[model samples]
Target: MSVVSTDAIDKWLLNRKWAPRDLSAPPAGSDLAPVPGDPGMPLLGHSLEMLRLGVRYGLKRYETHGPVSWVRAFGITIVAAAGPEAAQVVLANKDKAYSQQGWTYFIGPFFNRGLMLLDFDEHLYHRRLMQQAFTTDRLRGYLDRIGDVARRGLAGWRPGERFTVYPALKRLTLDIATDVFMAADLPAADSERITRAFIDTVRAGTALIRLPVGRWGAGLRGRKVLEDYFRRSLPAKRASDSDDLFAALCHARTDEGEMFSDDDVVNHMIFLMMAAHDTSTITTSAVAYYLGKHPEWQEKVRAESLALGESPPDMAALDRLGTLDLVIKESLRLVAPVPSLVRKTVRDTDLLGHYVPANTLVSVTPWVNHLVPEYWPDPRRFDPERFAEGRREDKVHRMAWMPFGGGVHKCIGMHFGMYEVKYLVHELVRRFEWSVPSDYTVRWDPTALPIPTDDLPVTLRAR
Candidate 1:
């Protein structure tokens, strides 16, 4: 059984003094209800509580304030929009009111002007150009190349009693991202340095104290390292015809022949690397943990993988692994790697009955929405069958199981990310039998994306 921490801290959040509604008043004769909720623990608000409690914190807010509420955290007030109905509104963005400005509150400095941070026409235009890189022929080439990297990446693992899974997978995914996205094959020393830089920047997203200290400071420095490296490397990437994403971006164009600027190429490369590496690492680790805890599912998935000949399964083969697909889906719902589909409204909007004003930071809370009992059965259980054809609880609502987010800004690399996870996990189950102690539960750190604070140890045995 999984244990969720709800001790003194959880109780404190449940009973903390509430904050009054601060959403700006709607223009005259407007009927949009004011957004609501408690601001936990005074000035610090729900920040620490959120980092400590992940979904448990989100669940409590859903129960107390319903779909839309205000959360004071990271030194700002945010409209914490939750549930499928609210998700539909924000992701669809019918009025064009939501922009990447919400992400500006956090990762804008690090990932600024990358695809995810652009708004409306600019975003659509950039996306149209970027789409050239992910074409079907290009993805197949990426898969073939990534297979070699995955094999080499995992070749170092040996049977062990307490293998630290998260870090190892993190390193491997960074290698994959570097090879497939940037096409730069660096020496071990450089790869290690760049990997550390990525980690610092990712963790810095949640750093409330923005200064020349701690993770935030490291992130600032990391950004400089990347900027210098990319700027220096851009001339070569531009001159080449390499199949990697770096060259693809440098060469991609609309039919009208508009292409990325040098700065655009660098910005997109930095942000895409983070998006692919961190989220995949988080999702893969979650799947590994669940498969370890539930060996029956693991064995069934192994059988499916073994049934297909082991010589580097292609995209078609990866798609054919039914059991593994279910497991990945279940894992994604449980973890919600991206967690929040962030946005900030450009103007006033009614979010599921709440009055949210212009310039308000609003987010569609996939972390909380994925756990709502109305759309899921036994929201905390690890039942892959919830996604199996007959049950198909994900169909209960279009936004219910949206780990990849939705609408225009839905993850551009999602298909690629999914294939990458399936490929890695497929290879893993083929090579080893892994398990976790019956009592083991990941204590996730929500300081950034929800990652395991304990390193996620598991036992590994070669098959």
Candidate 2:
């Protein structure tokens, strides 16, 4: 039994008063429809089921109902659209017709107006300016920085030692992100505090009973503490430039020579911080898990890395690291970090010829698409060769490979993301050999971002 907070509900109710139409349910005869699920108390719909069971429950609904199913969660009706074609259409459409802001409103107070939440012109405007940080040169620079960080972090892993590696990857990525993006050296203790704060924030969002002083409340408070700290630090950062994403964004200028306002920088930084750390952590952990389970694949990747030989992989060599790339692609398909891509239809619109009434929430989950038999031959298998030359299974379906999302606001950091992941793999293969525990049964915590449920306990042996 998940609990809804009175204050949170009150806030929504009040916001609805000023924007009555936005709060209205989709007009009754919309072409799209919802799949029926186990009953809940009246007025709650299947909100509890959707939140508690996460993707699995929705998947069951899809299996029974069809590709598209509507169910209520968090006081709103979310239409989970499965299949590649439907996903392509919805993800391809941008702006007022589709609202990212509405879909992400649960964490709105925390994420605020970060690039991921911004829509239409605002999203484009900020994205264009921020794009400066992801240019080829910038990506190369980020790779150099991340490689160093990964080397340092992996140096601590002892051989023949058993330990949970998921949390360590999370910690590693945060430290890398803080250094690479924020130019901050956040101490281990402080970094741990921030990571725990984020865990509490996401946990608070899903807790069945969100009491006033509970997890969600603590998350909001944690956010304030974070915001105040960054707000004060921005001035100092502005005065001097550094080789980090924060300084880059702080001093970034568009063609028109406009710079980010202090508020914009702060909000965007918070969002980027979370996005970079969590997504990278999950994807990297997934790679480690797969490699540990499939030592053959690990050797394949190791050979690919070694062939690149002593010199750091240049763009050409990076592309030549086909096996390495395939491993990443396969791992991402198996365990998509951003499993569910969400949006809200702002206007009554037709998706895949099925009409979605105004204000209806739209979700396209990659977890299903990645495994759809039509796009993948043996969707459940962990085979990187499927992604090799002439076997591009992902190319079989347009939406088949969207771990970083698609369309206008598609992960601006995507290239940067791949670069970092590849670097982590390159370093891991070069330094250590790892394996999962014999009793390792894989599961995921899907509430916020998908992460290994058992914390990915694994055994490490130095190479």
Compose the digit string of candidate 1's lDDT tens values, residues 1-463.
9676667656876556665555566678888777776555667877887776768877788887788888878888788878999889899888888888898878877787889999888999999999999998999989987898889978889779999999999988988988898887889898888988888888888887988798789998888888888889999999998999999999998888889999999999999998999999999999999999999999999999999985788889988999999999999999999888779888888888678888878878888888999888789899999889999899999999999889898899998999989999988998999999998888877778888888899999999
CA lDDT for candidate 1: 0.87
How high is the lDDT of residue 42 in model 1? 65
- What TM-score do all the candidates reach, one by one? 0.96, 0.88
How far off is residue 259 in model 2, in Å? 1.5
Q: Write the per-residue lDDT of candidate 2 for residues 240-328, one digit (tens) a residue.
A: 76778888889999878899999999888888888888888999999999888888888988998887787766555677777888889
What local distance difference test score does each model get?
0.87, 0.76
Clashes of 1: 0
Error of 2 at 431 (Å): 0.9
Error of 2 at 462 (Å): 1.0
Index of the highest-TM-score prediction: 1
